[model samples]
Target: MSEPGLPPFESIIAGLTARPLARCVVVAPHSVEAIAAVAQVVAEGAVLDLTGDRARIKNLLAEAEVDVSAVRIHDSGDSDTAVDRAVDLIRTGDAEFVVKGSIPTADLLGGLLRQRLPGRSACASHIYVMQLEQFGGRTVLLTDAGVNIEPDLATKAAIVENALQLYSVLSSARPRLAVLSAIEKVSTRIPATLDAAELRLMAERGKLGAVDVDGPMPLDAALFPESAVNKNLAGEVAGQADILLAPDLNSGNLLAKALVGHHAPAMGVVLGAGVPVALPSRGDTVATRRHSFYLASHLTRSAATSPNGCDRE
Candidate 1:
């Protein structure tokens, strides 16, 4: 869902580009796209820490003609070692944020979660930011696509909290959240609906802060005004949802992939961890990965200045 006067998603991406690039560690950058993406970031003046095969990294950077003056390498022969080293960099404040590269996402995230970081334990979840043409180029946020498989109510609550933290970083306005399900009515038979209703109640009780929460909503009713009108569903978030909390990882991942498959302007990040993590899929283009880095860096900057910061852990 959209607001009339808010800046477009493209503007946000452009703003991120205009800002000085933050220190980032690219973990296991062993793929073509990862190299290309990091190369572009380095060329654009980002100080980067790379953990991977030294020879392969140098060859690729030379091909891209990226200035190695600003790049630091921690040669690791194994992907797991690379991932662990990246986490250590963040844990030691050597890097502001992390960027996923060639390694399996599970390996990178497992390292981040299981390792003893600076902060206390927190539930980590992935959040996707996308500009969908179908929504009139509106930017939407979707959560748990990269983490949280089949979250229970407590985990869902944690995801919502993480999304709200991200929304605050992205906008000054209060975010409208929609807990999406297959239908728009509360029904005991559908577990998602039950969860949605409870979430809405939690919002009403100020448990989720000063945000507007609506749910047990179908996709159409959540974002499209016409659908909400036809369905007689009216709420602050019914047709203007800024954040979407999916029922589970299966649905969340599929919906997020659908948007990416359409080549929508996009970025993904993992929050609620001790540190912010940029998420780049195996097949993501250089542009996508670059934007993800910018987004994660932006989050890092925002958190650094704020007293609460973004780390839920």
Candidate 2:
């Protein structure tokens, strides 16, 4: 039976089974939740962890039926050294992904992005959270609330790219993106509205990939067909939006929370790196955490099986 008010984690896991797990280097392996997750994945493929509690880890491995040799458990006698070693693995290509364990987020991210990590061209990375909701009969992309602060136009563009890439990978379709604002019209007084107009043009000129872009939409017009029609917005994407590009973190975060607060199912992943990264929060329930792992795992596997982020168009 499915869990009450939450989507079955298996639904996401079943989708992920098509792809192999992304190799990860977990910092502070002493974390119970991290160890359990790693143990489950290690049965199929190995992951590296910086943990000195070898005996506990060993027991978890045995119970999970994972090969003892499949995982490389590193002992970081001190907290300072653990971060150093974890970062080293990413720099040396020993691990493709990093999972934050007992360590704080700031510490984990700081180490992962240490001056030496490759593919770092100031690409302006952000997290795109996709919730599988039956919202007016479609799935939509919501983002940046889980990452980024007050992003400017350039950073917003990059966030769009990240979301588009994931949509292309998962939905196998060119997402119709609505760059959201408080109102449908561009206004110089509102910075977000002005940026929305710019993004729309970027999409039209084919600079933002193969996607239909419309913008400066109010929240109602972006999500509901009647609202778009009532406002006389003339565009296929107006009502059938596949992605909603939030102006910034505050709006995006609030929207995501509202969805979950009303019992919507969500799965989020961090993108634009060499590999898929899972950044589930501690406050997130186990179901949310597992779903995120499914997203990262599936995306990694899909990328491996087919290049170009899974969109042939």
TM-score of each: 0.92, 0.78
lDDT of 2 by residue, 153-237 (tens): 7767777777766776555545778888888988899998988889889888998788888988986787777888987887767
lDDT of 1 by residue, 1-313 (tens): 3453235788888877878867789988876788899888877878899998999888888877788998899999898889878877886788888888887777777777667455422477899988777776778789878888888787788788778777887788878888999999899999999999999999999997878999989887888888889888887788778888999988999988887775777889987666688988776778988899998888775441111222221
Model 1 off-target regions past 4 Å?
1-6, 302-313
The deviation in Å at residue 138 for candidate 1 is: 1.4
In terms of TM-score, the best-performing candidate is 1
Per-model tally of clashing residue pairs: 0, 0
Candidate 1 residue-wise lDDT at 221: 86
User: Residue pairs in steric clash, candidate 1?
Assistant: none
Task: For model 1, state the Cα shift of residue 232 in Å.
Answer: 1.9
RMSD each, Å: 3.4, 6.7
- State the lDDT at 152 in candidate 2: 75
